[model samples]
Target: MGRFEGKVCIVTGGASGIGAKTAEMFVEQGGCVVVTDVNDAAGEKLVGDIGASKAAYLHLDVTDPDACQAGVDLAVEKFGSVDYLLNSAVKMAPGMLKDLSLADWNTMVNIGLTGSFLMTQAVGNWLIENERPGSVVMMSSIGGRQPYGMSGAYSTVKAAVKMLADHFGIEWGGYNIRVNSIVAGHIETPLTAYLKDPEIKRGRSEVTPLGRVGQPVDIANAVLFLFSDEADYVTATALNVDGGITRSVMNHMPGRKWS
Candidate 1:
């Protein structure tokens, strides 16, 4: 039997990138999933690929609290009950703080940080009301724990997600709910496809003790573990799935010499 056999899951941003891969993994593992995103075309196509009987698509805007709650309701409505929630939707606007507009800052904060909280709050509430114990896997970043220039808003909001995960992990312990974040490094997802230079991307990878950049599946594997019954005792932590990228902050200086 698959790890997620007889499970029900909701995957936000399931249209593409890491979210898409995670949704695929869940379904492949025998989980029935509701794949949600604002990208109607892509989301529907993914549902089709996963098989409508095994998966369904929903249009979602995670930043909206009502919408967030509604998405959870829909998941339970469709699949009986939600056993796992994966908050993977994000907006990464690259810019410096001084150069960024208030709009840009709010956009990142709302979409990345606030959105995760709302989803957790909404879903956690549902689980509580139904007396169901569930697991949540939030998508955090190496940027959240580390400081990087030219990644102003993205970095700031990611950091906020880490804290949110900690807070939810503690507060929801009574509910038998596990909340955690994945501090992912340079994963080759469509989201980071814009960084096309080999030198630029390779430099990020070379510092990793693993000697490679992360793949979406790497992050998905971590998510699978956190959501599984095997990790019933684990909660409220930001696990680094960065191929050891965060192992040495000092690697930065030495890595610069290679440039």
Candidate 2:
């Protein structure tokens, strides 16, 4: 039997990129998935491709608290219960701290941080009321840990997300709820599609210990492990799925091979 044979997962931002890949993985592993995203066309197409038995699409704006709760309601109404939540919705607004506007910062935080919190709360509450064990996986970025001058708002919100996972994990442990964050590295997704340039791609690969950028499947696989019973004991941890880019700082020195 598949690892997630009897599971039901709610995946935010499931229209594309890592979220889409993760939702696909969940269904492949025998789970029913409620795929939520702002992109109705892509989301609906994904549900059609995955089949109605295994997947359903919901038009969700994660920043809206009511919408987040409604997503949980939809999942329960269709799939019976919510077993997992993948909070992957994000808004990437890259800007240096000095020039970053308050509006951009708020937008980023509202989507990335507050949106995640709302979803988590909604799902967490459902699990608690149902007396079920569950897991939550948040999508964070390498920028959250390292100082990325060009991604001030993104980095700030991601960092907060990491801590938010820790806080939720601690508070929800008594209820058998696991919360964790995935610190993604340079992955080739819609979000990072611009890095397709040879120079940029090569530069990224040179710095990563794995010698290449990550694919959506890589992050999806990691999330699957966390969602399954295999990670029953894991919680409040930030797993880095970034090809060791975060640890290869020395490789970027002026005369180093990577440089």
Candidate 3:
């Protein structure tokens, strides 16, 4: 039961969704988790619910390098070392290039892309300074590898994060640190709960070979493996957690109806 016994982890955006699920798994595996999010209320509540002994919520804005460093420092102070870093904080704005505002684009890039870089740099520095081998799991999206027209900013930023991981893997491999990414598909999370349209949901399911949506735990399970010794040699790879949907093409039949 204690796969991560005595390990410490830092999960950005750990207030909910995949981050929360991952933190829960880490705690269950005997890893102490530092849960940080801009959402102080939810973050505190989540930490409280997860139990103070296993998790602590820290107020953090990943875009702020100082805050990111502080979060990492807190993790080390509390748990001796930070063995895992999961960059899962993100914001999605759906709009075509023409329709999207520059401000919106900047926010997406800053939070999704720059934030990841900052967190990695800060936490990575800590791990290196302390001479501790660690693993980093970036929560990228399948949309990063494909075109989701209205999601230009998010797509661009995610793709950038993926590349960042690869670069980190190469640069830090000498220190025994591993960096990898997960390209997740349509997982049923509070972030996507707004996709209330039944038709959209059906289409999402139909496109996936598994004929269903993914749960947060599905992604968490993969993150656990990546951070564990099982994946000690795995790095610089974007593992897809999309229910085999990435291989299938959507049917584009006009006026076609299926009962």
- Give the alpha carbon lDDT tens digit for every residue of 1-259 in model 2: 7788878999999999999999998988889999999999999999999999989999999999999999999999998999999999987777888998989898899989999999999999999999999999999899899777888588888899999999999999999999999999999988898788989999888889999999999999999988888899999999999999888877667763732
Output the better candidate (1/3) by lDDT. Answer: 3
Task: Check candidate 1 and list the clashing pairs.
Answer: none
Report the backbone clash tally of model 2: 0
Clashes by residue pair, model 2: none
All models: lDDT? 0.88, 0.93, 0.90
Number of the top candidate by TM-score?
Answer: 2
Measured by TM-score, how close is model 3 to the native structure? 0.94
What is the C-alpha lDDT profile of model 3 across 133-251, one tens digit per residue?
99999988888888778885988888888999999999999999999999998998888985567887888888788998889999999999999999999999899999987777644
Tens-place lDDT per residue, model 1, 133-201, is 999999888887877788758887888888898899999999999999899988988888844678867
Q: Give the TM-score of candidate 1.
A: 0.94
Clashes of 1: 0
State, as a TM-score between 0 and 1, how close model 2 is to the true structure: 0.96
